[model samples]
Target: MELRDLDLNLLLVLAELVREKSVSKAAENLGMSQPGMSNALNRLRALLGDDLLLRTGRGMQPTPYAERLAEPLNEALRLIHGVVNLEMDFDPARSNRSFTIAMTDIGEIDFLANLMRALERVAPDVSISTVRKGESNLKDELETGAVDLAIGWLPDLNAGMFQRRLTASQYVCAFRKGHALDKGSITLEEFARADHLVVLAPHTGHMMIEHDLGRLGVRRNVKLRIPHFAAVGHILSETDMIAALPGRLVNHSIVPFNLAWAPLPIKLDPIPLNVFWSAKYHRDPANQWLRAMMFDTFSEGAPHVSPDQAVPLP
Candidate 1:
């Protein structure tokens, strides 16, 4: 079928059908007549040439074709809705839109708290929700306008995407206040000797600590692995297991939690984090306002989205 002949509205019906698993339920969910949902489904089936759903043991199971199309198509529809709605400019004091962000869990501990505080004091009407950075690539998310910004030390992205450096985070080792490793400062040998708990991103191949270690040709004893960076503080509080964390987390978290932090003898490069988005939205008024708010919220160093963020490249 030619582009103009295809009804894009069918995707909404198909997505709802896939989610609700019954034509009647989908119709109810969308507040439409049952026959309307069926008609939309019929049109989708004709265009795609697939029995998009099958009445099986329990309910509708997607055909291979529909199953494959479901996620991307749903995402596309969501993006379209988001972009259309975003045409209205944001007023920091009056607008109540919640900006969705994707970042590492450590960000919740490191950045989220202060950012929320700043927003509460200034942009009280705004809200923020965070989704953990997982297998879903931020490049795709940013390009599709599905996410406003990605915040972290992502080394790989297209060269032309718009980005701004927030801050470079130093590394520190954390332990219970009186834990043996907390005595003074730690040498590389002592740090290497201690059993380590490395917090890794659950689904992605983005292990910053390990990658940094590999560059130095130095290896350490990693005993436990976790999927979330926010968990490290609790782990350090509860166990003797040593973990290297962003110095900001170490600093703000230590005294209250009865934890102590020491300089790691290893020279892991300070992590330079960026607030990045696609160039397509860079000039859009809403995007421009959001980018400025994010920068003002996180601004510490210079304002350049430098191609050379490397004080020393990781």
Candidate 2:
């Protein structure tokens, strides 16, 4: 079938149908009746000479052909939509749009509170839903719009994916305020000898602290390993185990917990925290607005360690 003979509307229905996997849900999403959606599906199948979707016991499942079409179709539609709205202005105050973001637990500790506070005054109607970074397939998730933005260190991100660096985060050692090692500065021997509390999150693992130490042929005595950052403050407040975490997270905890932090004795390059989005949404007005809001909120008064203070690994 020629492109001119095809009904462009059918493609939209097909995209939604494949995404929702249920005709009724797709129809609701598209603001159309179920019968209309079914008719559109039929037209798409006839024009493409394939049964794009199959009804399984679970729900509507996309055929091999539909699966192949899903990514390019979504990309094409996003480009068309973005071009049409290139000049549009997004008014966050009046719009009640919800955005999905993927970030690590430490990211929530460093960014979420400040971001929410900033949004309260300007974009009261906007809502944010956050998902934990998965062990893999983050790029695919961003491409498919399962996540609107991904924030944190994603070292393996594809070259084609678009990203903007938000800040440079260095590690700091946190301990209870009066701990023995809570001095003006720590020595590499003191840091290596101290018992440590490490976060071994499933998604991002141990934050590469061990690897960084390995490069210097030194390893900390990790006594406890937890999956999340939320428990770090309480654990460190009560125990002598020192935890090395992002400087921003450590700074955020200082007011609430009896936590004292100093620069890590061993040198490790600062990790670049970035916000990643698909090129498909690069020109989307609403997405652009949210990205800018994220950057502005996170970058304002963000703490940084001076270059002169950085100590090289012994």
Predicted model with the maximum TM-score: 2
TM-score for every candidate vs. truth? 0.62, 0.70
lDDT of 1 by residue, 1-314 (tens): 78698777777889998888899999999998999988888888888899999999977888888888889988998899998876656577887877878777666766777688888977898888887654347777787878878877766753768788877776677888889887767677787789888877743223666677778766778899987766677788888888877777677667667788776676566667777788888877767877776777663422222323212323
Candidate 2: which pairs clash?
none
lDDT of 2 by residue, 75-108 (tens): 9999989987668778998989899999887788
Error of model 1, residue 210, in angstroms: 1.1
RMSD of each: 18.1, 15.7
Which one wins on lDDT? 2
Error of 1 at 175 (Å): 1.2
Give model 1's TM-score versus the native structure.
0.62
In model 1, the runs with Cα more than 4 Å from the true position are 1-89, 134-136, 202-206, 299-314
Residue ranges of candidate 2 with Cα displaced over 4 Å = 1-89, 202-206, 300-303
Report residue 281 deviation for candidate 1 (angstroms). 1.5
